[model samples]
Target chain A: MQGGWHRYKEGVMTGVALVAVGGVLQAVVGRIDWSRAAFPVNLLLLVLFLAGLGGMHTFRSKVGLFDRLGRLPASVSALGWVMGVTVLMGCIRQTPSHLLSDGVEVWPDFSRMLSSWSFVLLYVWMTVVLGLVILRRIYPFRWSKIPFLLHHVGLFVVMVTATLGSSDRKCLRMTLVLGELGRFAWSETDRRSVELPWTVELKEFVLDEYPPVLVLMDKETGKALPAEAPLRWVLEAGVEQGGFTDWDLKIVRSIPEAVPVAEEGRLDFVASRSVGAVYAVCLEAVHRKTKVRKEGWVSGGSFMFLGELLELDEHVCVAMMDREPRRFASRVVLNGGNGVRKEGVMEVNRPLEQDGWGMYLLGYDNAKGRWSDGCVVGLVYDPWQPYIYAGILFMMAGAVCLFVMAQSGKWKEETV
Target chain B: MSWDYFVYFAVVALAAWGAGALWAWRGRQVGWVYVFTLSGLAVFLGFILSLWVSLERPPMRTMGETRLWYSFFLPLGGLITYVRWKYKWILSFSFVLSLMFICINLLHPEMHSKTLMPALQSPWFAPHVIVYMFAYAMLGVAAVMAVCLLWLKKGNPGEREMTLCDNLVYVGLAFMTLGMLFGAVWAKEAWGHYWSWDPKETWAVATWFGYLIYVHYRLEVHSDCRKSLIILLVSFALLQMCWYGINYLPSARETSVHTYNLN
Candidate 1:
């Protein structure tokens, strides 16, 4: 029993030493500015570092103490405990308590909770345990073990990079006025003014909107029937509605920008102001049974008058509506102080990345246009992004490998 | 083609498929049910194809549009599971769930426009959503299996059903992992951050972890069937929250960038 206790103590010490070495190596790598290095050099350095670590882990695992620490029943139990707790905490963070409150109002603040020493210790412990398990299980790697190795290693690298490089992550919101040079940003968190390395001279901001669509609605039932074609095509085709009410609707004329005009006591459409210009469509609806016809001009946003209730039958009343601006996007240019520049369109789902920072089109003043001011952009500097991406590649490759192996019956003999 | 026509055709096909499922359940000629199931799937695919042609874009933008794919894939997943495990009741359960979604789409039709939002214009969108729906369907089947296993505890699952359940969980988990990875990559391209811990993403991770727990429990602990089934049921709840319930969360409703308004 004494000998067993001594062996266990030796294993614990070895595990702790290995973890310390890993932490130091990660810190060293985290301090390196890979962005400043040439692409080939960065690639070579990353490969060499990974190889060194892999070699060290393999060598350590051959030692009985290190190997035993990895295979310990307690380690698996601890991993399960940590994972379960982390998931619970994630769920709690998404709850109303954390979500409804602002950062200042949040009790036991989320960012604080994540950055706490205990949380960090737990995170590091889980990572170290998982790394040890992967290292021991994947040594003298067979084709079957590759998936496990890649996945666990990928996760380890992602966690290490994200945690160690937290201080390097910076996010700021900037309002780039049209044709204005903006060089300063005030960090709300730090409560300090930060001088930007490059001046962002906004060349232009273009916002493009989608074309409007017309639809016919039943006033009583509130059932809308959308037209399949544009105004011009609708005029040519002539839509016929046949369920319960037989009405044939035809577009008489369509104007892109128009205003209501009282011409000879009759409401007519005329070319109007460019801003807030309403799309007007002149429609003629004919009742097939009654042989009665009514004509009206329906302008977008003038739903009250534009939707004159046309009596189709004793039970049916119809009106016209227009659906406009399904989506919009912003195009901007980023001019640097070093005479370097990059131009890109920032639409939803597409952000601009430049020199370790990413500029996202958060929103714009609804009244603004290509020549207008006040476009909100979110600038994020996350140094760990490259590592996260690399981790994703590894995980994806691992998944594909496992899937292919499963399909090929390579895992048929495996139990877990 | 109008939405009315699409709805009418889909309803008729679903009714026929339902009748075929009933016939199969009643121990009639199984081939007829297979044919009807395939026919139903084909009809739904045809409707989706027609919409794609008319819209001039992949019909995967809105909730109604995605429901079309979900409705199709649910049965496809059920059929695969049923074939692999020879579980006769699996198709029936899947059919019912698919029918419910189809009804929801028909009853509350969202505005069907030809416009694709710029964010959804990515190449990753289709595959990401498609794989997720497939994974959801498979997980749904697994949950049903779990429920059956729990209810019929007196009767042990045959070796085949047990294996089928485990394999389904494995495949579903894998697909879920792939979906999360794809979304992360897409997020990096779109939002500039891979993991924002946004409510939706947080719930997604919770769901993933929930299933991971089940995987570990099944593989390492070798727990009893009842315990495993309970874990699967809990994981399924998490999956549901990740899929749609997240939208109702105050955080998601207020601040989530992922909430694609149901309307």
Candidate 2:
């Protein structure tokens, strides 16, 4: 009974009991509806939880369970349960409940682990155990314990606030057509149109793309030729290339923006920077084996036109693929309607902030591609982000301490 | 400056590391080992620097680019371990793994695209990936030590070797924690959520928890070296799944945004 293994057995048994209780509760009552615990309820619950922890600490000597819960055995058992649950989550496919189609239920508990009752219960148990461990260490107040304190406290803050504050988070998509003042947004949660505080007008949607490349594509399979490692030749103006699997190719002329025009007998492309213009390239390909040569025009066409390819033979053809976007930005002006106007550019990963909301460039009309006249922006308001950041900062300091201790060989000395 | 010059740099780095491994194996002076290993690192660094300059962007957007960093950091981690614990055989272990990566790159060079998508063009991109790669290398060295202790050590290894193993895991876990946190912060700035339980993120957290269990297990039973070594190996396997195996998993292939576009 005095051995550490005995303590681990007791701790693990306690964990199993908690999980069983959670499962029974889940079966009795369906998934937890988080929206019910929105702002004031969540705040009240947080205060009560802290007070309960303090009471547990104050009465530790009166109860043997409290003391044991603060020990390493309990900590390890709690972490093991958490790890097991997380691993199960990784193995099973997860989808947000809202995204699933109507009346489709597949492995309900394992599929949506985040919203399941068992996961919430397990996390609550871990939080309580971790809080007790921190309290036990803080009372002694050794300078060396700062790192441990930081790591535990940081993790506690992140877990508590992120879960509690999730119900209060609001995310919506705002669409702005060209030169039009838009004031409505589609809520991601309910898919309903909601009025916004400000009106947005899109000034311009600029898209910069990489130069299109020509590839030898198989006529039958439609995959790039050679199948394994297809060779791509960049179509640049006045550029020439050869050594493409017994074929020599040269770019005779290239136009960034062009439109096809029928003149007399043959169709020719002339440069025109219009909204629906596509990239057109004129190239000459010579077959090395037979000395046969072919020349024509090819274009990675737009929504209104089909892409043109130069057939080398019945087996393969030289074609231009659609250019990949290098960068896309939406320049917009926002008006709050009372002498408050803001102008900025929003791009992916570079969100614009205003009035405690972050606006990110989400999508554009894919069918129109670069000629899209409207863009969709995602708006998010997360009040608890600051608290999460504070936790991350503390963890960063703890990590530095961990690195220094390991590098200086202090950990080995202390552990041994 | 381009991938065309990768073969030359790989050859030079392999030769220098090979000489260092030989010198260490022959039980020669420790100072010479540092000279040859560092010479190899410097040569590899030169190629990466030139490529970064020529591409006008960081060379960390593709699978092949990540391999370059892995090869560079493996030997550097080995040197750090040797300096701290005076374990000379660590060089041989790290160099062999490094050589394997270099050979893979030589056999099949990935397409080197100069363009990066809008979502990947963030300031956090470089540090998040670089830190993760470094952490992987450190954990890999610890895994190698675990294998040696489990199989090769005659019987009942002494406390010194176990201490070395523990030290490596501690450092590796620290770096891993930093890398995950950095990724979370980046995700928030880019996508508006700190964590969405994406398949890749789920696997990553599972790996972190796997290592945490090992650390606690070691603390609980210092006498049971066999169980602890097995735990370390299992944690390493989870790390591999987190790193690249997620790309192949059917559950992750459709929903995961972290998959590398091979095109």
Candidate 3:
């Protein structure tokens, strides 16, 4: 019982120390903001956690430090756990279209790509400390298994590389309209355009743009339901037409205690996929008199009262996934590609690269339209490619060595 | 001369592979196979780089260059995997895979040669592909091991299979671990955080976790049935998604750092 107690204590202490080490390493790596209370407070917690773990483990002395080491490996294990699934980390922030649509709070934020100040500081910190710690060696030290060593070493290199990537790399974008192509994308902005390291003529850009997706809504009540798209929208209903479809009012289930309504008579549209009944929507008598335009077409999430102009500036576009609808765009894509040269509006998803830095297709100029052509660029600088390669090499070498050892009759003979 | 040159490179690679395979089939001489594999790599390394560099435009931005890069991945992978030990016909396999892929690309003349779009203009594209492919190749090696293990269980542990599988698994694990790191680093620079939980991201992490569990099991249980199966299953499935499954997801079209071709 006494021995068991000692072992438990050792285990707890080791776990605490590992966590502390990891947290400190994180801080040193710049994952925390030293200026803020969080980092400093976290540092205190690190100390306490470490002390707690240490005290918990070392309180009983039946087991030595060596035996308690593996528990700490769990921290590294956790680190691996966090890093393995990378898609969850949204580096780029995408603003949803203004047009009323379903909420998407769970969606990844693309804003991470910009690398905020806190991020940059943490990146620098992570780089320097990760480098030192990797080379210097931490608590559990042994080169018995090359794969094991390489794995840890590789992770360190990766961390450093990521930090370098933040500072060194840049991104940009250029657009093509159908058959258009170009040898270069764009520079920091429209005024400056950088040629590609290699030339590429656009062979083709398959629009594959599907027909407009539609959502049906009632005339009196704004209860929306899904419907076949590209329908002729009649906003105003005739006085006699209100019989078929009832206004699906989202009545508040609240009692007398609830806050009073802010305003009445104006119904906020509620979205639904399908409704049991269809409503008749007739054009308003006076509204039909002037056929200049109507703004009732909901596109790319932006509902525009349609104008009479046949060519709508903002076209509804969707980027879908898993049969579920994703984000929609209602911006005009001005393909500035002319003969051999190509250019266009850049969005976060779209980017152009020239020289070495990449340019994101931020947005386009509305006033100048396609005629006023320019590209916005995001630049990146990376110098630690060699280090990355080295890390990969070492890690791989270690793995090979370990694998060979496993096959060397030593491992099998002993284990079997 | 150009025709002769193309034929020469192709023949050289093929010959090296054939010889290596024959030897593996014979007695599984890893060293000889390594030498032959590397010889082929040495022969094609420059050619491959030259081919990549020779593009008059951002060849990678086009579907063809993507195919070409994938093709190059095998040889490049063979070159790396053989750094310490040679697996049976590993180099040859990479060469053949690359050649086959590139040849298929050639069949589609319309998709040939395109310049980088503003999005593809990012220098990250090359490294991203390179690192990811190497990771793929490494995993390919691992898959070979997994196949061999099954074969071994069937009492068909050909000497070549054992050596190759064992070596490849090691190499693959290393590459995967490194790939995970590189990806994170790249993302941190490209995005802010090191890891995200997108489907692809989820699968990548799952792959890593699978490997981690494998490694952990190796240290603790040392290759239990449950662990091995879990590891193998996760590795293969995640790999499949990484290669093809994720792309099919309609959500994949969403703008992401991991998004390819769309840029």
* lDDT of each candidate versus the true structure: 0.64, 0.83, 0.42
Best-performing candidate as measured by TM-score: 2
Off by over 4 Å in 1: A1-107, A110-125, A185-193, A214-250, A259-269, A283-297, A301-333, A341-346, A367-374, A405-416, B15-34
Candidate 1, position B55, lDDT: 72
Write the residue-wise lDDT of candidate 1 on B27-108 in tens digits: 6787887888888888888888888888766887666777788888888888776565667787788889899889988877
Candidate with maximal DockQ: 2
Lowest lDDT 10-residue stretch of candidate 1 chain B:
B216-225
Over A1-416, each residue of candidate 2 has an lDDT whose tens digit, in order, gives: 36536667876787788778767776787667788888988899889988988888889999988888787778778887887788778777776766763333342466778877777787788899888888887876767777777878998898888888888888889888999998999988678898888888999998888778778989998887667667777654456664479788877887888988888987688999887898988878999999889898889899866788988988999888878888889999999868599999999888999889899897888788899999989989888889989888888888778888876666534332
Q: Residue-wise lDDT of candidate 2 within B1-263, one digit each (tens)? A: 88889999989988898888778877778788889999999999999989989877788888778889999999999988877777869889999999998888888766556678778888988888888889989999989999999999789757788778777888889889999998898888887888889988988988888887777767764337877788789889989888888878776777888865656
Q: Which stretches of candidate 3 lie over 4 Å from their true place?
A: A1-41, A48-416, B1-16, B23-47, B57-110, B118-128, B151-153, B156-166, B183-202, B225-230
- Superior candidate under DockQ, 1 versus 2: 2
Q: Write the per-residue lDDT of candidate 1 for residues A7-103, one digit (tens) a residue.
A: 3354345445543554454445432232244345555645664565466466764665344446443254444444454554444544332223456
Which docking category, incorrect, acceptable, medium or high, applies to candidate 3? incorrect
Decreasing lDDT order of the candidates: 2, 1, 3
Candidate 1's TM-score? 0.76
**What 10-residue stretch in candidate 3 chain A is worst by lDDT?**
A317-326
| C-alpha lDDT (0 to 100) for residue A273 of candidate 2 | 86
